[model samples]
Target: MAVPSARLALLLCLMIPATVASSRSLRKSPANASRPTTFFEVDRPLRRSSGRCSTLLLSASFGSTFNKPPATNAYSPPRCLVKAGGRASAISLAVLEWRAACRGAQLDRVFGVWLGGAELLRGSTAAPPPNGIIWSVSKDVTKYASLLAAAGKPTFTVYLGNLVNTTLTGVYHANVTLHLYLRRTPPTKPPPATAPADLVVPVSRALPLDGGLWFPIQSAADVASKSVALPSNAYRAVLELYVSFHQDDELWYKNQPGYQNGPFREVTARVDGVLAGSVCPFPVIYPGGIYPLLWRPIAPIGSFNLPTYDIELTPFLGKLLDGKAHELAFAVTNAVGVWYVGANLHLWLDPGGTATTAGLVSYVAPAAKTTSSKSADPVDTHYHATANRLVSATGWVKSSYGNITTNSTRTFALVYLLTFETLDLTIVADTGVVATDGAGGVMYSAQTHGNFPLGWVYQQNSLTVTHGLEETTVAAGRWSSAPPYRSLRTTQSSLVEDEEGGGKSWGVRQTYRYNATDGCYFRNVTSSNYSVVSDHSNELCVKGAASVGVGAVTAALPTVNLP
Candidate 1:
């Protein structure tokens, strides 16, 4: 069974040593087995060292180990270096173990980091130095655990041999950054197809690091559609940030293990507006949904109180689609203080995944787009269900949880909003040529304020996961019901229409922006304070109930239609 929670994967590091036979052999271990790990054992004396803080570029073969499945050989073996660190650093690197390959032509990428500051005082090398040094990969994810930026939360290790007398001791750093690259090589012409069959599989296709829509929230965050077409499949999402505390006027950094609550707070993220999703409260996950990943801050709650730090969301590389476009809507809220402000929210959507020329950036609200140029108009939109029926004219709207963040108490909340830009008109139909609302002769109407693909949240995922004991299995609910909605697909149905037969079902062809409610408020939590600010929280006061004027319906329309 799938590990119910991504939390269990955190322990994968402790089980690494036994599976990883040596620095030369990168092997996959069994999920059910545990083994003893090998500590960093450097036998020789300080052969060479660097004065200024820096990272050691260790080289090893990318050849596959015996345990690896032969099928993986069809793909190029990725090569890079990983310098270990403390608990937090280890877990941080462990969580990001997947993105290790380079884009087309490149075979390696940065996989880990080494943090600087107090972290550099010990472990000396015979090399030059800088006052403060930090090693990191160059991208940012919406969540924490970035390698370069001070705002990220990661774990790292220090080699015992570097202890060198009383000046330094070997232990791990709670936070460590990593720098990675593929071995330098000149580009060559494509190999002949008539080459040995053994060579065909390994070089057949490139890794998915170049650019395309990627599922950042694998199981945690869910989208209405799973697959979309992009230029190439080699795109990747990279997140880089800095974490420092702010007290009085000084900035304090956390380089050791454990959690840093406050006083240390500088963070950021980068992503493709069309290919990613984020959950608030730092460490967020869906357990059984698509993404099982979770974030756990090293610092404890109630630690710091400085106001103005942010996380950067960056998209490493992605493929852009022609004719069709993707939308990334960033829904954010403040965790504490009065509000939250995040700088550097950038998106990169490369039609060819690789940035051959200078990069380009475009900003748009997060909404899915259809091929037709029918963004602002709902010419054909309706909702239908196989089992549910249109009974009364009671007014009800449908929605789902969009963006979320931490509250003043440092806890998180889930907020809801609608999709699309028009007020959907749900017309009640009676068993006849024309139906009528209670107050009308032959007209019925209820206004829907937003677009299709509404969002909602359920509490069942959290309760059992958090409170469940060691052995109990957590339970997840099925996909929740959509609002009183229907999309007509004339090609799929027969002449047997609704009992009232006044309208055919209209499918959601496109979605646009509509009025947002509650402006900004705490979701899921018990807090009663909801504040909106212009300068501090980035909150906009755009509010209006979605409304639409409906015309009289003629008797028995054969096809479903939108207004």
Candidate 2:
């Protein structure tokens, strides 16, 4: 549908319209009823010159430039203007100059190339410094659209590309910056008066990298993990890069325009869409100006601690999205220190409808651990012991953010630590079918819940989730200080839960089975079966690893204390 032009001027201007092709195009404005009354001496196309700058001034005109406005509310224009399948006309590189005396004009065309994809810098570089090329073709036109009673119409979308690619490394100790601005035509008459106050859209929180958890160490270790959830809808993840860095503050960069303030956050991309970084503040170094560094990536772990931080990108996978099967690969710095890096397109979700999922990547202890040696000339000790018990754990928790009504899908990762000196660890879970009597009373499973599904167990330090069977065990001795380094591998298994016979009359409604040797075990379960014929019956199991120590420094000993 073609967007009308009449609604160009918004009531309380919040966002600038990228373009207004139709006479009734709807610009995001406040709900104040006002009309244009005065007529200005439409001056000759305003001529602006600043050396050989490539910025162009296009002609402005009135009357439906593309199509007519809607009849229902004669002023309402179409939501979109470009033909459903036609691409916008290509912008000319020549001296583009045009002028039209009118209320406003829709930006028909715009083209810009960053010196190094910088956002702030503009113009072409030859011998004269401030070298760069920027081309803009715009016309001030008006259009309008009817507002639905409940749902606000979606305005145009802004896609930021050509980012400076600064890697934000380290934990709470470095700074990052971003820049943003709206290109506008100097109004002929004084701009309209402002209302008492302006309504601003709250800035989105800075999303963390890899679901907010990075594991650079080869051995088993955990980091603090958290997530911000959104309702169930599509969104765009915006990233900001700064020009200067601040040594004192951990999250803020030196004063920079058009970027987000710190406190890193989770950025969401629109469902079934691709996000590419845009370059702002270009021309970091004039006359081939050096691109200012915006964000930096710093590794908090000591050089000897963990080789490379293992970032978890799993949480962002298969978010509420529909698309052909695709892999999500993150672009990260292979180097250890801070530097400028690029983020390439990784995954593409097609237009199919699928529920997006999110969960924890792993539980990490904030402070590092220290092992104390027993004796200076410690005697080599070796002992083997075995024991077993039942164990049960909850499925990964799903995360989300924003108002539930907005329908935004937030994703998170699930992770855990695994260590083995001489002993082993095992986990069991059951997959059971849920049964309900079409009312809001009791719920029962047809079979016992035991042995988590196959892909459920995260082996090799990486946690991947897939739909299917359940139950898995951590592999033994996958940890070495480096390579196989020190890690855990797990085997997963699953079973169906048997159901109870109608209301109260029941024997073993669900049966869980397990077999193990020499491993800590715990089980905590809470289940309820409510039937109209009887009061709700509840089954609760609370268990934990009975004897903690499985791996001791010199020999396998449960003598070591655990937190």
Candidate 3:
């Protein structure tokens, strides 16, 4: 029997006409009100010229890798680590530059990289155009310097859940490179400029596959946990978690009562057997979400670099630092379908002392207050709901540094308004959240806010819906500060989708800005029918761009205590 060639089996043919190319390097825009749009994402750029660097990581292509084992490689320090003077070259920083391209009909897939049993990064691929599309992402991994230079040779693993078949054929080609920056002259400071944790502990399983280490949460009872014998001198702790929803829970916020677990979901974490913190995860729209035409050269918010939640666990250290093994657990409330989750524990050890004594002074954690009411009228179905959660812990720790008292709080509220079986709406804001406070002053503080308002207008004939239109506005931001490390990132998108014309004729206008103590970035772009309409980007960062959107910032909601 002769098997059909994959290219012969054509899926939905997406005619992606190249307007120019997705780049600012090809056509530079003048600093004026009028601009020529380009295809690009609003990602922060790193100064590659800061020092001497080299690519010493893996570079390969992946296809038909679904359900099979992930690609693994043996890793060792590059030859550049040694100098001509017969001495070890001092490594100062690490950065990962990722580039990928794909064409033809295919679905969006998730990808990740792990080193020495710890995940370095996790992200999703973009839906490609017929003429092909290429995108790049740069991440600063300076904090993981110790792990990258650990003992002997460890395994480097790459996992991308992609499937190639006779019906859908799109082979993904990617280049994963690690650039190591060397230090000049000599070392002066006690700690590096990055101020990373003393040690990073992976809160994941040993399996290294697509969803290997990640726990699947389908219900409230399905909690993921691990036991660890942590360092006794650990004075500060934080959890950096990665999350992605699939199946029916993909658009969890838009779901309603009597259908797929309602419209509310909460993520919680604990130490030993005590509740530590909770949060309402962000509704990140993938590239192929809702309508694929809406995202072409530019993807939805946080697609390439998925946002990770940081939960301040310093107050709970009074229970964990007893120098014994303790259990760390994670769970989701009112979950449905599948939610893949995993985390890494970043611990800051007391530099002056080997051991520390700590005690919990006060703790307060209450159940979530929730309410919802649904009713149907002659023309439309009405639905409204709200959720609130609050948690706080205070403790005192005595070490060689001093007697430091720390308090952490987490609070968030959510309100939803919807009508018709074709539903929409969700909002979350920060009222007065003081994430972490020390004896001297506030060590770290962050107000995480999000408002994803959507509109659905369905056109039906008789008992069948003919076509529908979707308009979405995303107004979100994160304002955080830790002395010289203060920074703010925000963005807003105006999107419209037309299911007519065989699912064509779509457009989007977006604005993004990032400002911190170190750098600045600004971008505003427009797209129509999978092509660039207008684009203007600059290194000069601005403000108030993200505040312009369809909905107003709602009341406060439960937030993760960031330390």
TM-score of every model versus the real structure: 0.18, 0.18, 0.79
Error of 3 at 232 (Å): 1.3
Which stretches of model 2 miss by more than 4 angstroms? 1-82, 85-228, 231-354, 360-563
Candidate 1 per-residue C-alpha lDDT over 243-290 given as tens digits, one digit per residue, 9 for 90 to 100: 211111111111111112211121212133332322222211111111
lDDT of 3: 0.61
**Which of candidates 2 and 3 reaches a greater lDDT?**
3
Worst 10-residue lDDT window for candidate 1 reads: 489-498
Q: Evaluated with TM-score, which candidate comes out highest?
A: 3
lDDT on C-alpha atoms for all candidate structures = 0.18, 0.18, 0.61
User: Once model 2 is optimally superposed onto the true structure by TM-score, how far is the C-alpha of residue 2 displaced, in angstroms?
Assistant: 55
Residue 47, model 1: lDDT of 13
lDDT of 2 by residue, 1-563 (tens): 00012211220121111101111211122211233211111111212232122321112222231122111111111222111111111111112222212122111111111111111111111111111111112221110001100022322111111111133111111011111111133222221111000111111212122110111211112111112233222221212222211111111111111112211111111112322111111101111111100000000111001011111122233242333433222221111112122111112111122233433222211211111112222232222211112111111212222111111111121111111111111123221211122232212211222221211122221111111112222212211111111111122111111123311111001122222232222221111211111112222222332221222111121221111
After superposing all C-alphas onto the true structure, candidate 2 shows an RMSD in angstroms of 31.1
Which has the greatest lDDT? Answer: 3
Clashing pairs in 3: 37-534, 37-535, 411-557, 411-558, 412-557, 412-558, 413-557, 413-558
